[model samples]
Target: MSTPVQRLTAEVNGITLSYLSQGEGPLVVFMHGFPDLAISWRHQMKAVSDGGYRAVAPDMRGYGASSAPDDPALYTQFHIAGDIVGLMDHLGEKSAVLVGHDMGANADWAMATFVPERVRGVVVLSIPHKPRGTQPPVASAPPRFYQKLFQAIGVEDDDLHRNVKTFLPAIFDRLSGSSEHGAPPSLMVPEGKHFSDLFEPPSKTPEWLGEAELAEYVATFERTGFRGALNWYRNIDSNWWTAAPWTPGHVTVPAAFMIGTADVAWALFKDNGVIDSQKERVPNLLDMRVLEGVGHWIAQEAPDEVNDLLLNFLAKLEARDS
Candidate 1:
């Protein structure tokens, strides 16, 4: 059964974020991905709260019921990282174990890199560590792409805006490649999908999310709009430049990268290395396990496995603390 979601708001870094929280333990912060809200962590939060820690997940700057600012600059890595820090201060926590999925994982990487002392450890799901450095413009494919088309100022205007209902569903379907009503297929071929497809909704409704879950996301987006969330993609170049000073360095904290074996992202993992270019990126890297039959949404799709791995890892961290 799903844990009952509780709605709450906290001001951090000048932004007000509405989040769904449950459980009790050492403060834990969960960041959700695109088209998701803090409620996404319900399973994990319930699993870990009993360890005397507080399990908290925020809507992020613009994804849920969080305050959405007008300027794109506010959505940069530094600011997003600041939001996490601000959250810590608000909760009176000096440090906490951080976990992120998808874009949230990106922010987790930034947090660990910029403010090591504030983070005890990090567990990344789906997203891997993409170092900030010089790289040629990435090539794109028709169906499978990573270019951020939504970042453009006017892409969502006119026809696309009018047909968002149709667009969203189609985009989600293509991205998932599995009907919302059925089980997702194991393998994802690199058939040319782009970052532009991110903003649109899925052609079919996702089976995993019920009306309550979907309502939370829809309401958040409706209130916050998508600009703040899209700004993360918009500032890819800015983030690289900002990290240029810190780049060429490895993460010193204990870290793990969990990927789904069937996830297309695994294709990017070469030489058994997760991040490209830099060697020994995560100096204290513990493990990188690719779940046998999971997709990009590993946490949601395989909650039991994710929960067990996280518990074991956190237990070790707890042991050292004691």
Candidate 2:
């Protein structure tokens, strides 16, 4: 039987963040990515909490029932990381094992690097910790990265908003390795086309994603619009500028990085030595695992494996502290 998750809210970093939590013990906070809610970690939350750790997954600022700030500047890495710290303060905990996926993973890397003392351990999924490069990320990529496309503001938002249901399901299908929903589609969209153009109408929801879950995501995006979430992407350049001081900085805390073998992000970063470079970027990286048949949504696609990895990492942390 799964532990029942409690829906809770707190004033953190000047925003009201809504989160799902359960269990009680050492803190383990889960941060989700774009187009995802706290519920995205439903399986892992229950698993971790049941394993004797207090598990909390927040909807993140500008997401779900959380307060959405109009200014894109508010979504920077500094602000997001601060919110996590503020959450800890609100919970009366000094530090936590921070776990993040996708953009959330980026924030985890930031928190560990910016305030290593506040993070007992770090686990980042899908995205890797890439140190700031000399040129803007947009300018460096051969084909413009999606982050650059997102910087266009209204254009991408219009496309996504116009086809929320189609877009969401399509992305979920395309990113996964399973052929249950048919062959995954290419994510690359041509300059003149919308990102939604890449995917055809999905035949059926992938086994990893359910109709009810997909409906929930669609409803949330319909209510919140893509602006708040897109703002995070818009701040790419600004984040680069703000993170300048930490140019040579590395995550010195115990950390683990995981990604799926078929994840598009893997393709993007593989050429850049993303996995191989972790030794230098995260000197204390405890483990790095690439799931053989998984995709971008590792936690959701393989919840049991992800839960096991997390529990094992936590156990190792406990042993180290003891």
Candidate number achieving the greatest TM-score relative to the actual structure:
2
lDDT per residue for candidate 2 within 257-276, as digits (tens), equals 88887887787788879777
Question: Candidate 1, residues 1-322: lDDT per residue as tens digits?
Answer: 4345578888888889777677655777888877567777887888877555678899888666788787778888898899889988887899988989988988888898999999998888877876544552222223323334455654442334444445444433433424442333223223453333333455446665455655555554555555666767777667776787786646888877787754545655545465542236887767667677565666766778888777877887888789
- Clashes per prediction? 20, 0
Off by over 4 Å in 2: 142-144, 179-187
- The C-alpha lDDT values of all candidates are 0.68, 0.86
- In candidate 2 the C-alpha lDDT for residue 235 amounts to 74
- Candidate 1 ranges beyond 4 A from true positions: 1-5, 136-146, 157-204, 270-279
RMSD in order of candidates? 4.4, 1.6
